[model samples]
Target: MVRRAKLVNDAVELVPVLQLFSTETYRRVYETLLSEWRTLEELKQLYGEGVEEALRILKNAGMLEIKWRMPSDPAGKPEKEYHVSYTHLSINVYISLKELNTILNAIFMAEDEESEIVDRILEQIGRGRISVQHISRETGLDNLFIRALAKKSLKLNLKGQLVEPAKNEEV
Candidate 1:
């Protein structure tokens, strides 16, 4: 059976929920759950392995609601069903700089290829905010990967799929 709950309004707490919402997979998952309930298996079939992380993000962001349902057999284990916790979202844009700093950490050399990705993003967005798709085309890195790097770039600001130079600040 499917469930469609009334859209609930919840003001977001901070960057993670807002940031996760900007992701493609997260949006797709949220859309999928809007009109129907699905077991993990069902979601996995649609999204493959990416569903796990996406679901985790949704759950952590208070955007996914879950309930357990009994299986067909009397002795079988119950199955977990999932749906959207809220359909409406609002974000207050007045976060403190300290909190913003927490989300917009300076890009660091964490591993191989990170520098390359950061370099690419920096080079591409010099004039203005550029689409993640454009950076993906130039760097051959996936959009999601580039987004992850952009979030950490002190020199960059991420707004949805767009990445731009950090303003009124020295790097």
Candidate 2:
């Protein structure tokens, strides 16, 4: 079953698969799989055997393209390898520093809390739809209060503006 969950801000959404890749693992595999076409052995060497399954997950998510064939040579058969394919999504989920932190935090907090709001805030911020002034005025809260909340959860620094957290700190 494919489960589609709306992104908090509704700009981006997620398709739930049984095999969920962590943010870092997803980037590593995506880069490797796209940069140079590799057989499952090469992937297992760099990312571990678990990556074969991860690749299948991405394929099912429509994020990867797979090529499978059993070649019979005059002397012996050759193993199958995958080819690089264009990623369909335009929003670069891997490039943004702040959004990465927000996603990581959400993953950690998924058990006891509703961190979808964090993703919503990030999506709006990324789209330039939400601003610090707007957030403060809309919520009728002070800048410090908002920043504190952001810090506690997403670790973002919303002092001057609702900006991303420092790369050194983890939420």
How high is the lDDT of residue 132 in model 2? 64
Per-residue lDDT over 122-168 for candidate 1, one digit per residue giving the tens place of the 0 to 100 score: 88887453998988887686665566466544445667788886664
Instruction: In angstroms, give how far residue 9 of model 2 lies from its true place.
Output: 14
Please give the distance, in angstroms, between residue 66's alpha carbon in candidate 2 and its true position after superposition.
Answer: 2.3
lDDT by residue (1-171, candidate 2, tens digit) is 232332222111232221244456656776676666777777778886456546654553445555555656667666667643653334423325564444344344452343555554555566664566666665454443344345434224333355454243210
In order of appearance, the predictions have TM-scores of 0.48, 0.38
Q: lDDT for each of the candidates? A: 0.62, 0.49
Q: Clash pairs of candidate 1? A: none
Report the Cα lDDT for candidate 1: 0.62
Candidate 2 regions with alpha-carbon error over 4 angstroms: 1-13, 16-23, 68-73, 88-171
How does candidate 1 fare on TM-score? 0.48
Question: What's the C-alpha lDDT at position 79 in model 1?
Answer: 82
